[model samples]
Target chain A: MNHSVVSMDATMIQTKGLTRHFTVKKETVEAVRGIDLHVRRGELVALLGPNGAGKSTTLRMLTTLLPPTSGTAEVAGHDVVREQAAVRHRIGYIGQGNGAGHTQRGRDELVIQGRCYGMGRKAARARADELISALGLETVADRTVSTLSGGQRRRLDIAMGLIHAPDLLFLDEPSTGLDPQNRANLQEQILNLHTEYGTTVVLTTHYLDEADSMAERVIVVDHGRVIADDSPTQLKRDHAGDRITLTAGHTDDARRVADRARRSAGAEVTQSGTSVEIRVLGAPQLLPGLLVDLANDGVTVTGAEVARPTMDDVFLNLTGRSLREGGAEPADAGADGGADGGARAAADADGRTTQNQEIAA
Target chain B: MSTTVAARETNTALTGTAGPNRRRPSLLHDTGTVFVRELLPVLRNPFSVVFTMVQPLVFLGLFGPLLSDFPGTGEGSALQWFVPGIVVMSCLFSGAFTGSNLLFELQTGSHERMLVTPLRRSALLIGRALKEIVPMVMQTVIIVAVCMPFGFELHLAGAALAVLILAVMAVGIGALSYSLALASKDQDWLFWTIQQTLLFPFLLLAGILLPLDNGPGWLRTLGDINPLTYVVDACRLLFNGEIAAAGVLQGAGAAAFLAALGLLVGIRSMRHST
Candidate 1:
């Protein structure tokens, strides 16, 4: 066996220029472009992107499920390609689909998974019992996997991945097909497991709220490229901002207020009829002072509202497209934003008109 | 309190013995684990085993009496000559279709889960192939017993050797089936089309229905090329109380060769499947 020196640093996962490509209908599709990522030990990170954004592809490469087309990745301090077995032994991965066999009992599947990782028969049984109870799967663990509900099956998948208690865990869209209640329950279980075991957890999800509420660090990917990487709060603060909309007595007063907002550095001002919208960072502190100044200027302000940014806003500001709108165009069309400009502009206009109408109503 | 004990036990079970640096289990140990896992479903649902034997039993009842008056079958009850060929046929049909299970697993993502473990790649294929033996043995026993009351002589030692040869052949066919499944992962039609296309030719050329001795010279040449012919001939001889015959050695050699070749291709495909 070939042995390479394992990195002694606290880094749990590191990838440099890692890439993957596929051939579909004789055309080469680059699923994952050059991506450099580092995940420290015990950190919870989420790869946030829409469909076809290469988030799952990047996680697949790190988990040693798919070989990188170029560049290198080291997972759990072992080279993903050269020391694959060592890396596999040290990490657990739950892919997008359910991983347990349909005919086997959930408990039996967990035990066999433990055995695959070289646990003794008695020890594997003990661990299976532990996970069965710990994941609240005792009721369903004895039933066939296919008989369990989606949430139960997903939890069993998690238990299968954790049978060996690997130091690092990778989850690919773990909550894609579940209802909101089940999705929240699964998230709580994942968070609890992460806290108790101190496992380095990396998961990919398109659910903005899931990532926003769960992961400490969120990496935004689109069209096979990493567009932004930061803490969720920092990302919202940097890429998106609060929207402060004011309705005035007349169109002239709205126009005057827009001019004043334009004077504030980096505030994006849009005026329509008697309403003015100001997009700026820190609306909570700036809105009150702007209202008092307007009072002093004798401009009757009829309405005022401030809306904070969501993760969807962070993604929209980075890509000029909403993550809630499902599909992401390929790199050729999306790179220049030429083909998708009209649709994106219409969506933005519709959003603003709807917000203004709601304020009027 | 019990939850805490379970948690502590989990910690020790993970860190104390099953660490990353722990030595990997032997290939045989991993194969046994896979074999047991594969066998559990079959054991739980025994109806499938009986269902698989339905076609062989139908062939025996409808086709055996017609073979009695056929030429070149030699001087013996037709059941003796036909039962061994039926065993071979049953093995062929059952073993060649085993890949569909793997195809289902691949679709469900269970196979991908197994690949991420530290288990040896060869063990996955080998253990699956070995699992075909249990049902093959059971079908053979039932086929032999069903023919006994109809004047079929029971040659214990020769029949045992015949079972061994059939088991080897079944392993070979099962391995090839799994390799085909892996090759045609998303396109299930390819696996079925190939399996169905090749199945009858191998069966007819091997003379499992009627002796190929009276056929045309070109047919004899085709039979010589088809490896199943030797296995069928060898099994027929062994079941007829002629365990010392030279055809038995050639059949064993052919079966072993197929097993080795199937395993080689199967293991390679399993390793590179993703």
Candidate 2:
């Protein structure tokens, strides 16, 4: 057996041109298209994408749950395909659905998960107990998993994934079905664990706020390819600009403001009736100056507000479609339709949109 | 939130391996772990154990008296010939349907959780199949005990050998069921269709409920090709205290072949399940 040493700052995940295709009905559907990723240890990254954008497929490949149709991936310093057992030992995975048997108790599931990782019986018991308390599952730990509420079950799932204290962890849509309160609670628990253990976490989520609030880095995916990768702050600044909307007393004034706003460098100006909206990189600083310029031009500004850019705005700027729409590009949708007679692609997009609405609600 | 305490404890528990030298348990250890997990649900609900025996008991009670006076049942008592056949029948019904639990696991993603662990791939199938032995033994004991009052004598040594043969057959059937479940994926209809479709043919051809000698030549020929027929014949011979019968060796050979083929296909499917 060959043993490869891993340094503290070593890359936890590395993939080059990683791709996967699925044959839905004799016609191939390219789920992931040539994804290249490099994640260092201790980095909390979120793969931000709508449903069917292949985020889960990518996570599956990284966790060795699904073999990539083509390309290479090394997770935890072992090839995902060639050294699956080695990769499995070094990482933990919490898939999209509940991972515990319905009839088993949460505590028993945790212990069994530990035992699967080769822990001794005594050690497994001790670890299960510790996780039961740490994840606030002490009360529900003895009950059958099916009896637990969604929040409790999701927490138990997290505890199961962390039983062996893996150096790297993968979560697929961790908060998709969760209500706002439970989603916030789960996010806090995940963040706390990541911060305390310095465990590298790569979670996939279509919840824009989740990726913006919890992850240090967000990788935006669209049409099975990465469109942008940066911190939430940087992505907002680069892809989307803050908006400054001003309403004048008359249409002539709004038109004059739009004309002047266009003269400013890199500011996009649009006018509708008596309102002029200006999109600029720095709306806060530019708002005050623009107000003074309008005052000097003898144009009375009745209303003025600066709105900060959101993750949705960033996605819209990059893809020309709202993330909430479950944007499967028209061209890609047509291609999928042409290949499989349109029903599958249409239903898939509709299903994703419904799920996105649930998360949004 | 106790996060710090949990984190510190986890570090100690995992034993910071600086390299790929993490300690993995042997195959036997992993199989034992999986076996315990699979058995816990059955142990918790003891009623299920008896519930599964209801059908076999029904067959024995309603059908055994009718076979008592039938001609050409060989030299042994009809109960002796019928009891072993019921035991084999119980193994068939229970073992062949064990895959339903696996299918449920696949749908719930519990099996996927096990897959991501360091447990050997073969251990997953082996441990699950091994769990079938416990209930199988219990049912066999109950059937024999129920018939003892009806003048069915117990040959302890021969019955033990008969149980060993049934256990082997059970493992093979369980593995094959699990493989079918995997092949069917999450399609509940496909799993049931295949299991139900093949089960009746196997049962009828094996002639567990009747002797094949009185049947048409084509039926007898079909029974000759049925592996379960040999297994049932072996069980009857063993239960009759004929430990050295030629049928005993042939039944064991058929059982060994089934076990080997089942494991080969099962492990292949498990490895390629992703």
The sequence of per-residue lDDT tens digits that candidate 1 reaches over residues B48-125 is 887878888899999889989578777878888899999999998899989999988887779989988888889999
> Could you give the fnat of all candidates in order?
0.37, 0.43
DockQ of each: 0.29, 0.35
Task: Please give the lDDT score for candidate 2.
Answer: 0.83
Candidate with best DockQ: 2
Local lDDT at A350 for model 2: 32
TM-score of chain A of each: 0.87, 0.90
The parts of candidate 1 lying over 4 Å away from their true place are A1-7, A259-265, A288-303, A330-361, B1-21
Complex DockQ, candidate 1? 0.29
Clash numbers, per candidate: 0, 0
What are the per-residue Cα lDDT tens digits for candidate 2 across B154-213?
888989998998888888999999999887775778889999999989987898888888
Residue A298 in model 1: lDDT: 81
Q: Note the residue pairs that clash in candidate 2.
A: none
